[model samples]
Target chain A: MFFNMQLTYEIAGGDFGKAGYASSEIKKVLKKLNLDLRIIKKIAVALYEAEVNIVAHAYRGSLTVEIDTVKISVKAQDEGPGIADIDQAMTEGFSTASAQVREMGFGAGMGLPNIKKNADELNISSEVGKGTELEIITYLK
Target chain B: MEAQTFHHALTILTDVCIGCTHCMQVCPTEALRVKNGKAELFDNRCVDCGECMRVCPVNAIIVEQDDFSEIFKYKYRVALVPSVFIGQFPRDIPTRGIYSALLEQGFTHVYEAEHSAELLRESINEYITEYEDKWPVISTFCPAVVRLIQVRFPSLLDHMMQLKPPLDLAAMSYKKHLIDKGHNSDDIGIFYVTPCAAKIAAVKSPVGDESSPINGVINLNFLFNKTYRTLKNNDREQCPIPEKEQLKDFEMTWTLTSGESTHVNRRSLAIDGIHNVIEFLEKLENGEVTNFKFLELRACDESCAGGILTVENRFLTRDRLHNRAKQYLKDVSEGKRLHNKSIDQYKPYLKQHINIKSIPARSMLKLDEDMGEAMKKMERVRNLMCFLPAIDCGACGAPSCQSLAEDIVQKRAAISGCVFIQQSMQMKNKLSNDHALRIMEKTWGENRFDKDCTKKGAKDES
Candidate 1:
């Protein structure tokens, strides 16, 4: 109603074959929105990393993206084992992925770090054994 | 960024087009739209790949060419022929006969278009070695692929190798040779016998380079028919055709599929056909493809052998070229020095001027120049999509329903173009029956639904 656009996608867990589908779709829309290619690529990479994190480490997840003229905000909520130490999880090369997931190359522990690097803002909250909610925001300007 | 004024060689004969929508259905870029009983082309979106020409039933799509007599104006008329054209002759027609036939057709000299392909290969290897960060370098060999990247995948333009194609190098080398031999530049006219519409477009409007060295272009089908008839009708044995140096084994098959990839001294992939190239480029843009140092992206199925202007079957021409290459290889192994003296002598000069200045991406994907306006328009497009059927039926004259929606938002078309919507409005008494018929006729043609027995495949056809 305020001239803001929003998109939501239901991402299935453990479906590594389809991890990048949502990110690809989002990239297409952003391209149509005439965003700079550099910004679109950064958003796509960060969204893909977040989506793959859900597939490799969670039961299931949903991603919601809010778009305005000034900025874009993404929130990913997953139902799975939560991170104990968010700082440690954010550290590069600090992956808690299973041996199988690592072998498949899905769990590069740079997920949270990369999101923070590409996005202008990042926030994380989780319960011990419940789930995790990751929020990322990037300014359009 | 490059300017939006693209010179396309493919021209649709509007009077001859029957609004069949065949070309619209198969276009890879959705650049075609049928209106007023003829298919219209969006100049910026068309890459001149000639898929429309391939599918047109009534030969309405045609590639423009220089007049045949245009070569006669100059004292030195050089016929720059592609290897695919050479492979079109029958078995009885010898290679020398092909050259003699060209000589008979007012050409003072003949040269293979891929003569400098070897030199081009060396330059590409050096560039790939120097610029490892720009891995998976897409070849600018296919002019259609170069234009495709300019329009659809602007971001990947950095990965394009900034080098002129073999045809340009060949033309440059020959021109330099003629000048060195004391021929006046004004008197020399280099005409290329093009295998496809894309090359003709490239010759007319070169990208990444200042201007094409070729002065004119002759359609492959037109030239091939003339030469074939000449070789078949007359006794060419007495034609003093010298035993000139043959094309190297590599040069002979350079126009075939996978030919360029195999020559590249890198981990490369050769993808042919416009659709296949588009799919692979999409994966490349998405970061799915890796470890490739080179990409030979061709717009035709069997490479230049499948050009729209070619006369022979693509497979047959490919086999003939390979067989010709095999003979050349056999001659090489038997101590024959089939060397091109001009190219070898002009190697340093060609190498010195090999690199293209710049190729800017003119992306056709963006809806508007401003991000805010594009976003607003995109929102409107999404809203319109909810009301339109996604069946992609071409009855509305646009290639797909999405195409119609975008056109509507752009104000180039209206929502009433959809037949289904017109029917719904008519049932609701919102539109008169005559108004609905008028809308359909406006899109399809005037009197399009009439019973004409003269049309193709009609029951009471003439």
Candidate 2:
């Protein structure tokens, strides 16, 4: 089915103050759509974790969200130094965050795991010396 | 469906309101709005925290509590005194004197809310131990905070501790005590000497229960002068009231901030002040604040002592409470523990069937009534926000730039309401008008055209 609506947001890297703005806005949109609270919660958790990952690691990122009758799809692409090993990074308690980021409690290595747990489907693609892109889809049910 | 009746404990007198926007600015829930040059409250959105009452400079906002005279209607009147009310008096007055003063004022019996708080404390400990997996269990004692969760944090509703507030529990315990003493339940009326407007509302319309055990709420400030007079007129030589054992230090400190958590004695967080609580709740909802078993959130700045209806200064009252608690602890250490078995005897009055229902989101904040249209309008609002100055000056009659953007999209307001937009539009129109006149002058040679056009018009008329 065609998407009923779409929204996009620009996220600046290291901008901790506004890290969750996009996810919160999407959450509000989903709430207005009258989706199940549990579904909205899962989407919020997944999107927020992905958004924060971009802010913490990437130089800049853009999040594009599409909502349809059946599901919500989110695509986040960032311009920054790419991950060296996807498998290692996805492991719990594995982090390459700076000391400053760790101090701010962002480098718990739970971000990807949390996103994976909440999203129905998650796709990650990255190239060395390039940027990273994450695609997350959550069913309305 | 029948419309739900909300308790408007805090009301604004429209005639006295100055429309200064101070209350609207400070409101944590964004419940207040300056409409038609007056402050208006959305009843469903308001939590009756008395924040507006405190910020209103003209004293237009008033807390509507039950009249103290209403207690006379009942044959048996019981006063449920909050711990904060006891700390409001001078330090020299013995706590027993306050009890006797209540009795002298025609109350058949007076029960301290602290006792109920102790019971609730025990219940909470048991609840935490049993539901150990439910991390970050929020306190349900503050009616305003509970209502806030209902309105703003509906997702966190399940996290709320399902227990009756101290005031309600106290009334229940008092009723049982009176009934055990052979007085009929129907003849007795329970009155809560409340420190805040939220408590008054709670008594009138309880959160979890269909009706409250508390029949009426008398504001502490309203009864302060009368209680003081009663204490002053009493003869010191004739002490008719027996001295009861002082409350434990932890129970006595229940009226102040962080007091509730000190009893939990675990990984807990105590957040006071509505704004601070809102901030913490947002973090909590986002899964930022974890590893804590309990969260004691109070809507008032210094908890109950900072209530708007209280007469005494909070800091001073807090100090006095601490001193009294220290004395009570010293007495307890001397093998003088008060044997109050009521805590163990009575169970919580919270009904197993009834629970607090979460309220729906306020429609006033919605961009459109239709979800699809709202999404479209949300996009438009985003575009409008880009053009806005983002200064949140409130010059456009909206609280912030983002709100103005929403108002513009809702068609309740026009983009021209923004001063910057209005000035730019005016300038653009002026520049265009000037350009049109300049073109007319250049094409028609100013004076020559006026003369030639007039002559030609006269010839054509002839």
Candidate 3:
């Protein structure tokens, strides 16, 4: 059987207190649906890292989650200074976060790598003066 | 699979409840709900933290404990005293004096829970040294914290220390001692003097152990008045106090928070209070907290001393216990002949491995029993929530606008239950009615209707 549902959440930048609220809510929804624990943990990790990236680096962002029987697809679009070099940004230990952001024990250049490790498919597109958008999908089967 | 046993030590008196949301809001597990002017507990979700009992203004919630009278049925009665119980009294009172008092109250033998804690600590140290892979081994001493992990963080089960609690160890040890002295096992009854309701529930229906070695649990608050009287009336001032080696400073400190982490000589952190514990566990789950060999998480603020059933202030008691521990160490340094045994001589009483199982979700937030139906309802609820005011005013008798939307999707409530929706609908009806009246007046003048009505009436009269 196949089913689908979508949820959207707005993420405000520098709101550290509510950074993971969206991911946690989605995790609760998935748990109630009786999904496997391993699958839920993987998706939660990837989604949380993506959500935190928006809060730490972007001015403001929005997350649209598409959930179906076989997979969960997440798209995060942010209105912030976009990445200049996609290949370099994808590399571990490379970051363009501010000093204040790094002081908060984030922006270790591990966010994208961690997300890629958990997600089955990841796509990134950015405009230097415009904004950045990321799409992540993890299979539930 | 065998059916799991459910035990709840909390009871609510409905008549005294004011339908206040204090308990509902403070519950860490969201196990409580106010329905129809009364508080109801979702038994499977409650961790028996007793936070509701502490927050209730009218004392409507009560902890259920085994009666002391039940101990009389056995030929011999053993009292397993948690170290926190000693902190309830004044510092001037000798530790041996309390043991003598318990014996005076008809206990065949009195055993300190700290002794068992010391044994468990040794075993854990050895276990950690051997299994270095499990760096962050969470302590399993606090029953409430253990249950919280079982319910909320099932993925972290492998990190929990696989050992029985100190009270269970003490009960098993005393039982063996009596049996060795030619006493029948059936004739002896072991009762733990507990500081919290969680321990009572833990003993009755334990999550890890196959069955609890302890027979019954008695609340310390219930025994305080009687023990206080016994301590005052006993006149043994002339008798020489028995000299016994007290537990090490580290062992005695187990009654309070951060004691285990500091004593174990490892990289560790201790978190206390249910809210703080929950927060820390979330961080750990998110991979934010690392590099610690152990994590001591207690549900109560100041560990067992801060339990709801405890009478004295946790800080003052902690100070008194620290002073007693210092005195104990001083006596040991002076070469006094105090009866103390080596750690190697003591064997584990747990005997069998304790298996902790994850609790299945109750799915209270799910809209239906079936996953597909629940997903459909969730979509509808989300759409309905967008139209709500989102003020969370509670005027509709639900806690929040989101909850009202959920209720509507569940068919337990109607959208009109919202005051704003009802007002808008009434306004629309009034405006439409006025519009219909205007159209009638425009099509037919008011005087024409009056003349037609008069002519029809005259014809009927003729």
Candidate 4:
């Protein structure tokens, strides 16, 4: 029989050091579930990039994750200047992160694209001045 | 191996990780992550390169090497020495002096790995020259680097040089040497004098398509004291050379990262230390530089001299090796001749490979389709983190406030598991049940915890 878990993380912004918080927690949850290795990795990559985005751009954010017998789902919402051009931001080479973030070895512009590649289904909604919300789904079956 | 099987390999000190993600940031395999205020290591994905062990500021991560007592079970012990051993001692000390010392220390046979290293070097260059169309021919000298490439950049497996590691090459060559003298292979136990713990782990559980040719590992530090005593005595017989031309020293020079660059007979870029190597290789994976035909990478800074397990100072070791290499090359022709002879007599050891498949990492995601419970847990995590100071000091029973919150939410831990949170609760006289309910109510908002969320019920009284 398969089991399900729901996890949550309150990611604080303005901290470059604590960037991958939500993603790391999700990885721990997946490990305990004994999901397929491939699916676990995909969820981890997508969720982590999303978390980093919130910390880098938002003032504060929260991550909500849902896991079941055959599938995993994640939703990240942040209070920040939402993405102006969703298509451009999703592009592999498009990045808006500052020089400081790059020095720490992040802001590679590959974050969004990598997230896209890892998730089975991904949705992003943003209103330039409002905020940003991301939803991701990955299936193990 | 499954993640469940390797669970014991995960070591989270809880207090010292600082949640910096330095290990996670640099891990080529993406086996680490920072949650809350501490770093968590994934067991299934970790290859145990000791990068975390080396980079941690508080010495929180630890990867221990197997003891020499493992060698006691074997009847015939053969010592396989890497070429870098030449960089360890003074130039005046005869190389065979070290060999004789190993004999006194219970090893039955000694082989200078540089002989195989030279042979492997020549073979790799020839392979590169023949397959010149293969743009970047990655060196196979560092087992840890090979693991990184295989795990993080699987598509670039074609870029790796087909040759086995020098120690493996030397072990196979020695097995053949013993066979020619009418000895059985199983009777002789081959032990590599390793520069790092990765090599020891590699010997125990090798990656990729090959099994380790050597049976065991002996760190340089463990063997140094005894060998040094022998160097002072100047007593035992010299190493039995199969050929008179094999004893020349330059063949032993490839101990450092740049050591292979010199032997490759071409312009090559050498990188040592973990962070720099990861960056350059990532660039390579992205096809950043196409012109550089050869690249030598080492995980430790100062090449092998700065290895994770070495006892000597890396800077001092580098200077000593540089000075000694200069003094040994007085006769350039002899150096070239010695290098050529070692190559002509090379042997390959091929063994049955045991697949070490990757395992899934544990998820911190929700256990049910209940968003209501997840929201409640998020609120709990938020409250804990606010009280956390974000120092990730790891004093809490969990790795971080985030981790503690996950535990609390999942019923694996409690909010009071956080010492800081508990202390704050005590200071405010809010450790009572009513205050705990109030803390939850305030963080999650009034309508936050629905009947669906309370389906699991509250397990922690606090």
Candidate 5:
């Protein structure tokens, strides 16, 4: 039987300073689990980019991370302005970020592209008026 | 995954330690714990920062050093003195007087540790440019910080520059200088006058490289006292030593804060103090802190001036080094030509030996080698954590409730070792009072609970 664990963190949007808290906590737990450094690095980048994306766009969100010997999974669910075009949003330099957000060094539009490159699998679903849900997974075995 | 264990120069003498928990509170890595009426070290977790020694009430923690007589074994004895060692002396004592004192203390020759700092800066700039992909190249100058990164921040291992620090390069240059002068390598000894235990440990069991060029380490505090007595003697024999070139303006403060960062061509930040470094590194790892091309991180607060073994105040030492550097600049502007022994001549050989092997990451956070086993232990620790108090009182001999739970899951301690759990068990008639007392006695030795007037700050402390 595979040993599994789950961790959840509440993310407050628009607070750029408080972003990446969830990613760091997840990284600490993964380090303690004796995971491969390369896998951990991949997870760190993907999870961090996703975590920052929610802060850069949404009003509020929550992150749930599931870790096991076979695979690791992270899902970011946020309640705010959602992406209208998924394919276009995934393109590099295709940022819809405001001047203020861009000034903060976030919302480079490389968020989805980075998450796509680092994660083993990526899932995205959203409504225009509502929030967006992003699922990112990486296999360990 | 690395088989080589970390070597620590600090020793906790149980005979002298009273299990006061002063040291247990200050360890940055949580490597120290009170056990059996004494503090014990977890070698892998300890980076030898010497913070514990700084806070120990009884001065029970000691940084080990080579015996003075040991230097006599080599025909050509060399003391590689760092600038901080000179910073400890009063401003009135000239650098030449200190050098003479070292010679009188059985050293045949002396070499300044930062003589290679000039070369080190050039090499570091080249390395930063060559490895452009690895932005924010972390300096490997501080050995304690190197070990800290190895154990705690293993993921950031790639960022650590493979280049050796000035001390290592200086030692290599000194050894080569002696060997080139027809002295056998075996007959030459290079001892470092270190300001902290971390340097002692680095010389003994170096990281990134196979072996250190240093033959031994002499703690700064011990050597300071030895020279202080010699300087006080008015009738002391004088050694008419040749005038060797002292540190240049930038080189004098090379070991101080902002020394490396001030010289680097690109964007760089100098972070001193172990806790500050940890906080900044946490942000860097999560991609929060960015844009810096290089980071010069030191473990001590004021860089080497705040070394644990240093006798003088850190601020005073820093001021002295700054003044010393200013004085050197004034001398240069007055057309005083610096004499001889230029380390710049050996750049070819120093460059060849400066690049160290890649530093491997060794995560101390892992509960076990296998991922499956580590997951199991993590689960057990989480389960145990629920019943334990989170106050982090060191009564359980472990540093905190979390660590005690971890120790219990690893079978190094028992859940009943917790006083709260013992009290509850006694209330439920599951544990006898005598049994609880025995458990405590086991954790903290017998008679540890007895009232003693000789404890720190007590009336009969003498």
Candidate 6:
């Protein structure tokens, strides 16, 4: 019989040091299920980059990592300054992180692209001066 | 699917945990949860990556490693050594001496993984040249980096270079060699000389589509002290590792972040240090810096030299890596092309079944046969998160404040799991009531609606 589990991690805005916690737990769950390593990795990357973006760019947010026998899905929502340009942001290498983020070794702008790369399907929506929402899914058949 | 059977290999003692949340912040899997008064561990989600054990300040976390007694169980043991071992010892320590030392450790045979590195380097170069149009290709060398991508950056899976890691390649080669020598395959066991807990976990429970070629992991730290003492009396240079000319240069290259770039002259990017690499990979994903053809990312600051389990200083280890790289340069010849046919033959062996679908069992854990229980659990989780010091210290058994809350809500953990929450609870019941209603109201809004509707509500809250 197929079973499902949903886990959540809160991404604190401006906390670069605490990034990727949710993604890490999601990875652990995927691994325990004996899913393919490559596929698990793809889910991990997408979830992590999105989580980091929430902390670096958003006011605050939470990442819900949902896993099941059929697929792995991550939904991240943040209450902060949202993306100004979804198209521009999706382009590889585009980022708005500040120097402090760079000092912490983030802000290189691979967050979105990496997310796109790992998930079989990705949908993101954001409003400037508002918050952002991301939905990512990776199949596990 | 039961969470109980999933062992908690990495752990923290409540009194010493300190609740810093560093483990939560750095954990790639989001496995930790901090609740009421202490940290609680979740079994079904832990990968045993050991990042928690490495980052804990009070030494509260401990990682599980196999004992030497495990060696006796294998009939024929093979050692899979990482290329970074070249930098750990004195310059005078020859490869033969190292091989002989491994023999003394109960390994029936020793194969230098450097050959796999050479094979991987050639394959990557050929692939990059053939697919030059592919923008910003990422390296598949580091297991942790790969896992980070899988769990945190799945969208970029296509960007990851399609190559087996050096250890996997080496294990495949070792198996082929064993078959050629007419050894019983079932009797032979491959053991990786792991440099980090992540590698140990990788060998035990790999993330991607396929199982690891190696049978088990032996931490270098667990063996280094004993092995070094054994080397004191053995012939320092008596064993042989074939000829330098026969060795593949790719293995030599796995020592540094620029290792891939050294082999292929492409517009590649390389970054060491976990946080820095994450940023660089993020930028690469964001299209902020799009000129590179390949990216070699490492989790450790000095590449493998800074692996969590290594004994040597990162700087010194890096210096030694440089010295070894230079020595290997003499062995490369333009005539030295990797046998493409041989590489293809090994493909079926390395390729394993992978499922890109979301993990079903995990998602099932989220559902409550009882909606009321689930809602109540969500309330408890939200309350726990609100009280979290927000330090993400990981002192709580869970990785973070939110993770702790989720665990509590899911009924995997309890309210008193976070020490800070208990401290605050003791200080004043008023603190608990401060935003209890508000937090619950927010949870109802965010959790009860779809993103479109939730977005509208979330905007107002923000």
TM-score (all chains, Cα) for each model: 0.93, 0.84, 0.83, 0.58, 0.95, 0.59
Candidate 2: clashing pairs of residues: none
Best by lDDT: 5
DockQ, model 3, C-alpha based = 0.36
Worst 10 residues of 2 chain B by lDDT: B440-449
> Which ten contiguous residues of candidate 6 chain B have the minimum total lDDT?
B353-362
Q: Which candidate has the highest TM-score of all?
A: 5
Q: Which sections of candidate 6 miss by over 4 Å?
A: A1-141, B1-30, B34-40, B43-49, B57-76, B129-134, B234-250, B330-462
**Residues A81-139, model 1: lDDT tens digits:** 98999999989888877888989985578778988888889999998789999999989
**Docking verdict class for candidate 1:** medium
Task: Output candidate 4 Cα RMSD.
Answer: 12.2
lDDT of 4 by residue, B318-425 (tens): 776666556556655455434444334433332221112232112323333444344445556656566666655444434455655556666765566455676688
**Per-residue CA lDDT of candidate 2, range B50-151, in tens?**
888897877888877677789998999988887888889999998888888888788877777877667667777877887776678888878889888777
lDDT of 5: 0.87
True contacts kept of each: 0.44, 0.12, 0.25, 0.00, 0.70, 0.00
Better structure of 1 and 4 per TM-score: 1
Ranking by DockQ: 5, 1, 3, 2, 4, 6
Interface RMSD of each: 1.9, 3.1, 2.6, 9.4, 1.3, 10.1
**Model 3, span B57-161: residue lDDT tens:** 777887787888888878888878877888889988878888777777777667767776677777778767766766798888898998888777765666888
Instruction: Point out where model 1 deviates above 4 Å.
Output: A1-3, A14-19, A55-59, A80-94, A97-117, A125-132, B1-7, B240-243
lDDT of each: 0.86, 0.76, 0.76, 0.63, 0.87, 0.64
Q: Which stretches of candidate 5 lie over 4 Å from their true place?
A: A98-107, B1-7, B236-239
Of 2 and 6, the candidate ahead on TM-score is: 2
Q: Give the lDDT ranking, best first.
A: 5, 1, 3, 2, 6, 4
